[model samples]
Each structure stands twice: as C-alpha cells, then as structure tokens.
Target: MEPSNDIKGLIRQSPPVDVSKPYDASTLKGKTIVITGGANGLGSFMVREWASHGANIIVGDVDDTAGEQLVASLTAQYPDSAFAFQHCDVTDWDSQVSLFEMAVNVSPHGGIDIVVPNAGIILPDASIQFEEPVLKNGRLPKPNTKQFDVNITGATYTTHLALYWLPQSGSSPRDRCLLLVGSLASLCPFPTQTMYTMSKHAILGLFRTLRSTAFRNGVRVNMITPYYVSKSNMLKLPVEAAFLSGTAGGATIEDVIDAATRLIADEDIAGRALCIGPKLKSAGVHGVEDEDDLMAVQERENNGQGRAVWECYAGDYDNVDAFVKRYILLLNAAERVKGWFGIVTDIWSMLRRK
Candidate 1:
C-alpha cells in the first residue's frame, strides 16, 4: 500500500491535547504501575514519573543491568515506597506472565493499577541512517526479525499477560488500564519502516479489538502514538528521513513524555491515537468518529429487523453504503448461526462426556 499521502495527512493532523491546565499527578498516588521495557526511553521516563507521584512500580525489561539500576535508584529515593525490577522478554508470553505474577506477589492489596506495554524497536535496515548506506535510498536493506519479535509480538504478549495476571478484569469501578505503545505509523502509512510500522499498526488494532471484547470484563485499553520520541530508536533518522518526514518537525523527547502523561490522566479518551509532541496542547491524534459511525450504522441495522440486510443484498444502495449494510447483515447472520451451533455442540459434548 502506498503510505505517502496517508502518512502525510495524519502527521499534518497532530494529536490534540487540552493544554488549559497542567496534568494532575495526585491521581497516581497509591497506584501500582507495571511498565514493560522499563529500562530505557519513554518507558523508563514513565516509570520515574509514576514512582515520584507515590505509585508503586514494577519495572520489566530484558536489560537486566539497566533495569536493576533504575530499580535501585528508585528504591533508594523512595525508601518508604515499593519498587522492584524483573528481567522479562516482552515477546515471550511466559516471561510477561512471570512479570505479572511477580508484581501481584509484591502488591497483594492492589492488583496492577496500570500496565504500560511500551517495549518496541525500529527495523534493522531503518536503524541505520542515510549517511552512506550500501543500499539505495527509499529501499530498506532487509526484513528485521528482531523488530517483529520485540515490537509486534512483544507488545501483544505484554498486554494479554497483564490482563490475565492482574485482577483488573471485572465490573468494578476500580481504575485499571492497559496502555499500548503505538506509533504514528499505526494511524497512517510509513514507507521504509515496514516491520516497525506493521507491528505498531497491528498493536493499535489489537488494542481496539481487546477494548470491545473486554468491555464487560472492565479492562480499559488505550494507545499513545508519539510522532518521534527523541533520542530513541523510534526515530533514528533526521526529521526529513522519509517521504512523510514532515511530521517529525517540532517534536521532541519532552513532547512525547508530556503526551504520554496526559494520556494517562485523560480517563475519558480511549481506542484513539494521541500524536504527542514537545508541547502538551499541540498533540493531535485521531478521534472516534469512524468507529462511532460504524457502530451507529450497526445499531440502526439491529434496531430494525433484517431490513438493512435485505437492502444490502438487493444492491440498490451506493457503493460504500451498500457494502457496509451487506457486511453487517452477513455478520449478523453468521453470529446467529454460530450462537445456535455453540449451544448444540456444548450439549452434545456434555452428553458424550457423561
């Protein structure tokens, strides 16, 4: 898919932030934050911020040396508070689960207050800048296996493990969150950073799916797609590194940091991207209009008896509208059949077992 125009449009529309007031840190007090990839970059920064605000922290990272050092520093600083570190490979489900279990063991009174699945890496070919590349411009060297393992699979595993290990999935009013570290790539096309972009976009979709599927379970999921977190692997190139590189301008490390913090504070926002930059208010991400429109269409269909389906199958509607209606009808019919089949299968299986 040609990502040039799409990425350009998204970057032009930066994340919108409410800079009317500074973020309140009091909300984090007494909370327990579990951060994957807590050793460095934005994840580490978040850990420190949460810890300073009286939140207990469980730092999970593959870099044991750096991770342990951060923990030691926090432990010394917050002698009265709780802080610990665990060596974890976020790509591995078992390792992520172990991290969650460890967090629970440490904080029995409170389950994981918030989970930040922030571990990610840039593609290998994209990792090297264009100073004197052996390969031609615009074309990356090769596929990056490490990027896929760490960015895509790693982020997915971390989120699921957090939900599984933590006692946050319920109908209670308790505040529990799963924040995925998505990228601007998730919103639009990123030409060269194939693996990185693929992973990020997939993570965004995963978060959205989990949000709807786990709504009854009370597992709130969200994502933050910073344009270019400074001094990090997310953006090793200059601002004009790629064709859609204009979005990198004016974005700094501080911008991404503030944006992430603001995301955590804004409880009303979810299932949307937040393009963070140096200033809090300058951030502008996509809204829920598309999703809302789709939902509204579905509700209309379900409210009226399969008429929407008939209209769709009749093929008299406009292209987009007809496609949507037909898709919804097919989905509804499939769901009905599946539900009945499930009931019958369950009964048969029970009888056989007996």
Candidate 2:
C-alpha cells in the first residue's frame, strides 16, 4: 500500500530486523509498565524479561495464586526491580480501573510508561454449535459472547485507560508506548473458532486505526500477531489439526518472546506489526537475486541469524486521506509556532503575575 499523504514522513516501513544483533536491554531500566493477564503464558514471560531489565512491572490477572507466585519470583530474582500483582477481571470496567490505579500507586514514578493490553480468552465451546442452541418455544436463546467480552471489550477498556494515563507519565514521549497482542487469526479465517476469530480481527482493526493517529498523543502503538503457539490452552484441537495438516509447524514461545522484545526495546519503532511463526532462514532483503549472496553480504555487514519474526502491514500509514494530511499539517504548524518566543512569553506572564 502507498503511504498516506499525511503520514508520509511520520510513517515508513521498518528496516529489516537483525535478531542476532545485541541490544542493551538496560534501555528499559526504571520505566513503569502495566500488563493485563500477565499471570501465565506470554504475559508471564514478558514480566520476567522486562523485570530482568530493571523495569517496574505491575501485572493484573484473574489468577491470584499464579500471579502472586510470579511476582514473588521476580522480586527475589531482581530485588532492585519493583513488582506487584493485582486481581483483575478485564471484562469489568471497575476491575480494570482499580488495576490501573494500583499500578500507578506502586509505580516508582507514579506514572505508567507502557501499557500492554494482553488479556485474551478463547473458549473451546465458543463456536455457534455450542453457543447458538436451537430456539426454545419460538424464541432464540442468547448466545455466549464471553470471548468478545474479554478479548474485544477488555482490550478496549485497557486502551481507554492507557490513553488517559500514558501522556501523564513522567517518562518522555519516546518512552510512552502501547503494545497490543493480536493473533494469526486476526489476519486469517478460523472456521470453527468464530468468537475467537472475531475478537482478534477486531483487535487488528483497532491497531490499524490507532497507528494512524496515536502519534498525536505521542504514544507509539504496535502489535504482535503470533501464529499458534503450542504452550497456550487457547490453542485447541482444531488449531492443532490445522497446523498438522499444513506443511508448516506451530510457533514457539521463544519466537513470540523474541518478537515482543524487539518491539519493546526499539523506541523509534511505531505503528508496526510483527508476525511470529515457525523459525525459518531469514529471507534476506525482499528482492535479492541470490540467497547465498545476500546472506554473505549480511553476515559481513551485521552478523545475522535465521528469524521467525517478520514485519507486516508496514505501509498502512502512507497515503492517508486529505483530512488526516490537513490534521498533521496543523499539528506541525502549531509546534513550529510554539518556539522560543512562546516559552519567553509564558515566563514573562508568570513574572507579571508574581
């Protein structure tokens, strides 16, 4: 897709990532991060990784026992890092509000630098066959939408809170980011998992829309769309069957973590989506005539390794509508107007009042 006219300069395709290169994970030190559904699976792993880097982490999850254990482990491993766990039911607004409040209260800076709306659910019996039972007495029964409530509604609540709190975070604008967790289902069709598919698709839509405008809030928004990972309970029999039938294997937890780490560590990266799947040799740059030739060149330039993480939808921001272009232009103009003169005028006004 062509770059949107308004975001022409602001948005560009992400450069090919070199996973083998070393990154100073310490760059995340002292930042306050809040994550929902962080008791197990990917969320739990992220908590450990971020804490190891010295980030103050607040995890909210419904699993009290697991969440407490995770927090205790991290606290013991990194005594210098602040770690807390709060009981949260993402489907409820009050619960989520309390979770955010707790995060701020425990934060070393009293503000949140990052928010991960990672809470999601997929019921084994979520499909229409189980949820949409036959009508009784000519009246249709209510279908179960718990999947929607947790995945879509919960994510929406988290996003709303992030927008309200992230700007107020003491951290610089470059540090303020929202990392959303989507699924391969967001892009592909899941025939039997109707609710799960719908919820993920909704998240994809949310990510795309926010990426186009999140810059206005100085919050970088990115997404991770992982193919089925064998570790999660959400990956039911149907998912496994599909994977077995296909030539490709399922993704691994390490692969997902690798992708997540890249997004979290790179401050300049914004409005990008990373898809994590089975590991494969790096394709090298998109039009290289010889794989061996490209690999040799890449090795000389920067030692490279095979990668499972690939960028998707990197150009959605380019070529936007006229309204967006005008809006961006106005913002740029306003910034330019608020130069040194604006600062001086504010100082003079304060002196006169004094």
Query: How do all models score by TM-score?
Result: 0.67, 0.78
**Model 1 segments more than 4 A misplaced:** 1-22, 108-110, 124-143, 168-173, 233-250, 278-323, 326-354
List ranges where model 2 is wrong by over 4 Å. Answer: 1-6, 11-22, 128-139, 171-174, 236-247, 281-306, 321-354
Roughly what TM-score does model 2 have, to 2 decimal places? 0.78
lDDT of 1 by residue, 52-121 (tens): 8788889899899999999999989987678889999887888888888888777635577778888888
What is the per-residue lDDT of model 2 for residues 1-354, given as tens digits with 9 covering 90 to 100?
Answer: 953244435533345455566666677899889999999988998888888889999999999999999999999998987899999999999999999899888988788988999999888575755545787799776778898999999999999999988888464444788999999899897777888999999999999878766777778888999987766655666766765575567677877876887787788777888888765554455665363323323333323544567677665544445444465476675443233324447668999994
Overall lDDT per candidate, in order of appearance: 0.62, 0.79
| 10 residues in a row with least lDDT, candidate 1 | 306-315
